[model samples]
Target: MKSRQIVLGILKSGPQTGYDITQLFQTSFAFFFDSSAGMVYPALRKLEKDGMVTKEIVPQQGKPDKNVFSITPAGEAEFAEYLHSPVEAESVKSDFLARLMFGEFVDPERIVQIVKDEIQQESEEIEQLQQRLSDYLPSHNRCMSTGQKLAFAYGINSSKTEIAFLKQWLQEHPDGK
Candidate 1:
């Protein structure tokens, strides 16, 4: 999904300032998608211009002004339209797959190291997903939060299973000794 669509989803939840959106992105959307403030700000402006959202400037005592955005009825309609659209194919750009495909020409030891590094990273990601689940599963008020929690759980479990498969593959190789 494009960053614009993701931002619109966030705004649909409630009115929020640009800074708040950035924080939300870093905390929640970091797993599924990411966008910089540069992208978010421009997208917000375009959304406002298109009548999908409205902006309000809040004056701060000692800091810069904050631009808060709230989704309109049109925005909700647009979001619903997008939700009804068919899912798009995922982009396939896996570096590990590319390496494994051409691995006959590469150093076997280095490939093992690469696999080790990837598993380590996935372990940390799974930990983060676990934390999100613990915080949200039983009592989160937001419906989307529950959806997000389940999605993260699925992702974390899938990654763990893949890692296990890779570990088994490495173990079966004599050179892994």
Candidate 2:
């Protein structure tokens, strides 16, 4: 999904500043969606310009005013329409996968190192997501729902698969491990 849609869908929960939205991306949406810190502001501006959202400047003590975004009725309708639209196919863009595809060009030792590093990173991510799921599931009035929990489960499962694949690949391309 587009970052604009993600931002608008988030605004439906309540008004939030760009920082707040980015934080949500980091903590909650990080597993499934790939939103960058830079994407939030531009999406907010476009939404505001399109009258899909309205912004309010919230005053803070000893800080610059925060621009909080709220979804308009039109935005809600738009989001509902998006929900009705057929699910988009996810486009994979993995540098590691690409590198592995062209493994012959790289040194075997380097390939082994890369897969090992990926396994470590993926394992770490799985651990973090497990912790987040634990914290999220028990919270009262949590932002996440059963559907979101399922998504987290999917991520955990995918990460497990990735780690397994990497291990096997490393074994096949062994360089005196």
Candidate 3:
């Protein structure tokens, strides 16, 4: 989804400051979406300019005033329109895969090292997601919707599959052995 639409959907839950939205992306939606602070701030500016969302300057003590954003009626309508639109296929972008594509030119030992590193990285990521799910999911999973649980499962499983593939590829190559 476009950053603007993502912001709008987030706002539907309630008003949130830019920092709050960023944290939400990091904690809640990181499994599926790659939202950065850079993407979010610009999208918020554009949404304000388009009159799709309104911002309130909330005063604070010993700190800067926060810009809290809320979706306008138009924003809700726009988000609904996007929901009704056809879903797009996800485009995969992997630098590791690109490197492996041209592995013939690289040293064989280097390829083995790369595969090992990737397996370690994916393992760490899966651990982090599992920790987050355990920490945040209330009531031992009673509070989580089926789709929310499924998204986490997808991330965990995808990382596991990638690690397994990398390990198997490295074993088959076995040039460093």
Candidate 4:
């Protein structure tokens, strides 16, 4: 998803400064996507120019003035249009799968370590996603479209299955041999 669209949605909820928006992306949106100030500031500027969103300067003590932005009516309309648009298919480029495909070239020890770490990471994510899904279930926020909801489920299952595969591999190679 485009950074601007994500930022716009956040703004739609309420007004937020650039810093606040970046922090939100880091914490709440971290699971799905991420953005740095480099990308966010530029997008905010572009959104301002495009009249999709508006920014106001607010003075802050011991820091520079903050640019607080919120989505305009035009921005909301544009976002709704994007919602109706077809989603671009995600590209699959897995380095782990590549290593597994050419397993002979990889050291057995490193392969085991990689699989162990990968499985652990995915397992934690799956657990967190399960919690998030439960929390989001009661919310009336129709902002999460069907596509996004579907992807979220896919992400949970994908992580779970990946962990399952890695665990099976570990069982098969008890000594990492």
Each candidate: RMSD = 2.7, 2.4, 2.6, 3.8
Model 2, span 1-177: residue lDDT tens: 898888888898898889989987887788788778888898889999999999999899999988988999999999989989999999888888898788888787877887888899999999999987777656425666677878898999999998997788667768914
Indicate the TM-score of model 4: 0.75
Please give the distance, in angstroms, between residue 57's alpha carbon in candidate 3 and its true position after superposition: 1.8
Question: lDDT for each of the candidates?
Answer: 0.78, 0.86, 0.86, 0.80
Span of ten consecutive residues with least summed lDDT in model 1: 136-145
Q: lDDT at 158 for candidate 3?
A: 98
Better of 1 and 4 by TM-score: 1
Q: TM-scores of all models?
A: 0.86, 0.87, 0.87, 0.75
Question: What does the lDDT come to for candidate 3?
Answer: 0.86
Clashes of each: 0, 0, 0, 0
Q: What is the lDDT of candidate 2?
A: 0.86
Q: Per-residue lDDT for 23 in model 2? A: 82
Residues 1-177, candidate 1: write the lDDT tens digits: 787777788888889888778866765676666567677788888999999999998999999988889999999999888888998887766788888777778688877877787788888988887766565444446455567757776778888997898888788873643
Compute the lDDT for candidate 1.
0.78
Error of 2 at 35 (Å): 2.5
Please provide, for model 4 over 11-118, each residue's C-alpha lDDT reduced to its tens digit, 9 standing for 90 to 100: 887898888787766645656675665788888899999999988889999999888898999999988887788987875667777877787887888789878878
lDDT comparing candidate 4 with the true structure: 0.80
